[model samples]
Target: MNHFIEKTLQLKDPNITIDTEKVDEVKVNGRFSLIYYGKLSYTPKACECCGIINNAFQVVKNGYRTDSRITLNTISAMPAYLKLKKQRFSCRECG
Candidate 1:
């Protein structure tokens, strides 16, 4: 499943991951595009302020923001709308 998603999405690295189980469908709203809802995250996040790397320790999911971006992939002769849950991380040590 992971391999298929990596290939389909053209993900180059293992650190960059996506949760495909969160969404059930490739929503076809009209003739313009398809919407794919998913969560996006990067492993071994680093603190923006302190430059501290957190693989697990002192790391927390502060919040997530809904983000939309244009991808090179096309679906049904239309562009793909990747609705991503962009994760925000914080470090307890930095705070």
Candidate 2:
């Protein structure tokens, strides 16, 4: 569950959701590692580019960027990582 991961990782962001669909277990440098995927998405209250309120149209979802690789404290002596998919927002009024 998303809450389980958030609690475990001590994440305070409500917009972040842990994607447990397919957890990756890979070998790196001859050692095994675990990778967790997380997605960050939220509607913007205001446009950062023009400072205009969303109002259902001013700002819109602009898809997500590639997952970023972030190192985490090793779990049980094995390396751990997080692949975060950050959402993008575009301001229609500014564009």
Candidate 3:
């Protein structure tokens, strides 16, 4: 299921996992769009902002960026989108 969507949409990010059974039709800026739900998560080896190594008491899961809409190439002439809940990390050393 995940593999099918990835191949069809050309999404190569390993962190992204699509909910293949779920899809929605919605309006974006007055135009109809097709949206697919998914989640993005990964364990980081280092903090992206401060470059501090990730470990105990270092970079950790802050929460997530939810309902982020990313545009994709049109599917069957309709605008396609990915609604992703992306994992986020916070650097204890920097913040």
Best by lDDT: 3
Give lDDT tens digits, candidate 3, residues 1-95: 77988999899999899998999998988999999999999889998888887767598777888688898999999999999998988888998
Ranking by lDDT: 3, 2, 1
Separate clash counts for every candidate: 0, 0, 0
lDDT tens digits, residue span 11-77, model 1: 6756545666753334455455655556666644677788787755777777777575646487457
How does model 3 score by TM-score? Answer: 0.82
User: Candidate 1 overall Cα lDDT vs. reference?
Assistant: 0.65
Is candidate 1 or 3 superior in lDDT?
3
Task: Give the whole-model CA lDDT for all candidates, comma-separated.
Answer: 0.65, 0.84, 0.89
lDDT of residue 22 for candidate 3: 95
Candidate 1, position 28, lDDT = 57
Which run of 10 residues does model 3 get worst, by summed lDDT? 53-62
lDDT of 3: 0.89
